[model samples]
Target chain A: MNKGLLIVLSGPSGVGKGTVCSVLRKKMPDLVYSVSATTRSPRQGEIDGVNYFFKTREQFQEMMACDALLEHAEYVGNCYGTPRDFVERTLAGGQDVILEIEVQGALKVKEKFPEGVFIFLVPPSLDELKQRITGRGTETQDTINHRMTVAEEEMNLLSHYDYAVVNDEIEAACHRIESIITAEHCKASKYLAELGELPAAIEKA
Target chain B: MNKGLLIVLSGPSGVGKGTVCSVLRKKMPDLVYSVSATTRSPRQGEIDGVNYFFKTREQFQEMMACDALLEHAEYVGNCYGTPRDFVERTLAGGQDVILEIEVQGALKVKEKFPEGVFIFLVPPSLDELKQRITGRGTETQDTINHRMTVAEEEMNLLSHYDYAVVNDEIEAACHRIESIITAEHCKASKYLAELGELPAAIEKA
Candidate 1:
C-alpha cells in the first residue's frame, strides 16, 4: 500500500476548521486526525485517546524532554502537545495524518518535518471574521476584540505556510485542504524507489 | 478578480492524459487548454487555432526569433511551439491556463514561469503501459517497443516535476489534477496581498 501524506492545518478561531475537518474526514476514510495530548482536565463527553490523550503535567514534561512531542504549547496554565509516535504509526500504516494545530505548533512541526504540508485557513475578511466572533455570543466584547487582534498577528505569519485557504465557505475550504493532501501524495520522490525496483527481466528487455 | 494560475502538465505516452485532461476541462469551464502552433499540416477535421495555430515554417521561425514562443521543438521535419501571448492573455483574463505539452516543453515552461505548477502523469506500471499501447492497435509492434523505450527516458525526468500522479484510473487522475490546481491558488503568496491591503482603520483597531 502507498504511504500516506502528513498535512498540518492552522487557522485563527471562528474559521470553521473543525467543521471542515469533520466533513473532510467523512469524505476521506484513510485520514487519521491526530488527537493531541494535553495536561488540561477533559471536559464532559471528551473521551481519552479519542478526544485527547489526557496526561499529567509530569508526563507531558517527560515527553517534551525526550523529544517525543512534535510540538507543544502552554495555554491558560495547561499544556497541549502532539505526540510523535501516533503520527508516525498512522503514516506507517498507510494512513494520512491530519494535525489541526495552531500557527505556532504548525510552524514547529514544519521546522521538524519539512515534508509536512502546512495550510493556514483564513477568514474571508476581517469584518466577516469579527462578525463571526461576535455572532458566537460566547465571548464578551473585550474577548472578541482580543481575538481580532490575535487574528492580525496570525495573518502576519501567513507567508510561512505552504498554502492559505480562505474560509469563505466551509465546503470550499475543505476541498482546498483535501486537494493539497492528494497533490502532496503525488510527489515524485515517494514513487521513484518503487519504480527503480521494476523486474530485472523487464528492465533488461 | 484574481488572475488565474498557469499549469503545465506532461506525461509519457499511453498514460491516458488526453482522457483525464478532457474530463478536467469539462468539469472546469474556466480552464483553457492551450493550443500549440505547428508547421505540420493539419490532418482531417482539424481546425486552425483550435487544433493548432497552423503556422508556416517562416512564421514559426519568426516566433522563435522574437522569443514569442514559450517552448518549441522540432520533430519529423515539422516544428511545434507554444504561443506565449495567447497563454498570457488567457491567464490575465482570470482563466486558468492548462498546457498539455511534452516533457521537454513542460520543463521549458517551468524555467520561463517559475511559479507554474508542473505535474507529471505516470501509468501504474510499465507492463500496464505497454498493454495500453498495444490495446490501442494504432501502432505496430516495433513502434510500441520504441514508445516504451521513450517512456523510460521520460520517467527519468519525473523528479523535476512538482507532482507525479498515477493514471491508474482516468477519473481519479483528473480529480487529482483539478485538486492540485485548486490547491496551488491557495498558496499564501497569492491571497496574502489582498488580505494585507485591508483598510488601515480596521487593521489598526
Candidate 2:
C-alpha cells in the first residue's frame, strides 16, 4: 500500500472552499482534515481536537518552539498552527490529510512541506466570487471590497500551486479534487520506493 | 477550452496496453487514438487511415526527413512512425490524442514533445506478466525468454514516465488513466493562461 498524500487545499475568501470540502469529504470519507492548534477560545459546540485543537498561548508557543507545528501564524492576538505529529501519523496510517488554509498559510506550509500536493481552488469567475461573498450577508461593503482586493492578490499566487481547481459547480469541483488525489497517487515520486524494490521482487518471481 | 493533452501510453509486451486502451477509448469516445504511418502492408480488413496511414517506404522516409513524424523506427523489414500532423491537429482541436507505442518510440516522442504526458503501464507482478505472455500460446520458449528479457529492460525505463498504471484490473487501470488526464488538466502549467486572464476578467466583472 502507498503512503497517504498530504494535500494542502487553499483559495481566496468566498470561493466556496468549505462547501467544496464538505462535498469532498462525502466522496472521500477516509480523508483526514487537519485540526489546527489555536490559542483562541473554542466557540460553542466546537470539540477539542475536532473543530480546533484548543490550546493556551504557552502551549502553542511551546509547540512552535519545539518545531511540532508544520506552519504557524499569529492573527489578531492568537497563535494558530497545524500540528506536525497528527499529519505525520495520519499519513503513516495510509490516510490522506487535507490542510485547508489561506494563501499565506498555504505558502508557509509549502515552504516547510514542499512535497505536499498544493491545490488552489478558484471560482469560475470573479463576479461569482463577489456574488458569493455578498450572499454571505455578514460583511460590510467596505469589508467586501477589501476581500476582493485580497482575492486579487491571492490570484497572483496561483503559480505557486501544483493544481488549480475551479469551483464552477460543487460536484464538478469535488470530482476534480478526487481525481487529482487519485492521479497524484500514481505519480512517479509516490512510487519510487516501490519501484526501487521492483528488481528484488522480480528476481524472487 | 483547454488544449488537449498529447498522452504517450507505453508498456512492455503483454501488459494489456491494447485491451486497456480499447476500454479507455470506449469510456472516452472523444479521445483520438493516433494513427501511425507504416510501410508494412496492412492486414485484411485494415482501413487505410483507420488502422494506419499506410505509406510506401519512400513516403515514410520523406515524412521522417521533413520532421513530420514525431517518432519512427524500423522493425524487422518495415518502418513505422507517428504522424505528427494528425496528433497536432487533434490536440489543437481540444481533443486528447493517445499514442500507444513501445518504450524506445515513447522516449523518442518525449524528446520531440517534452510536454506530452508519458504513462507506463505495468502488470501487478513480473510473474503475471510472464504468465500473460505465455498464455498467448503463440511464442516459442526461446521467444518467451527473449520477451521476458525485453520486459525487464522496459521496467528499468520506468523512471522516465510521469505515471504508472498497474493492470491488475482493466476498469481500475482505465479509471486511473482517466483520473490522470483530469488531474493533469488542473496542473498549474495548463491553468496559468486562465490565471493570467483572471485579473482582467475580474476588473470587467
Predicted complexes: DockQ each: 0.57, 0.73
lDDT string, candidate 1, B161-197, tens digits? 8888889888888888888888888888887664565
Which candidate's TM-score is highest?
Answer: 2
Whole-model Cα lDDT of every candidate shown, in order: 0.82, 0.86
C-alpha positional error of residue B46 in candidate 1 after TM-score superposition, expressed in Å:
3.7
Best by lDDT: 2
What candidate 2 gets wrong by more than 4 Å, as runs, is: A39-48, A54-59, A75-79, B39-48, B54-59, B75-78, B195-198
Error of 1 at B122 (Å): 1.1
Candidate 2, residues B41-140: lDDT per residue as tens digits? 8766679988688999889888989999889976535787998888988898888999987777899999988999999998888899999999988778
What clash pairs does model 2 have? none
Clashes of 1: 0
Chain B TM-score for all candidates, comma-separated? 0.86, 0.87
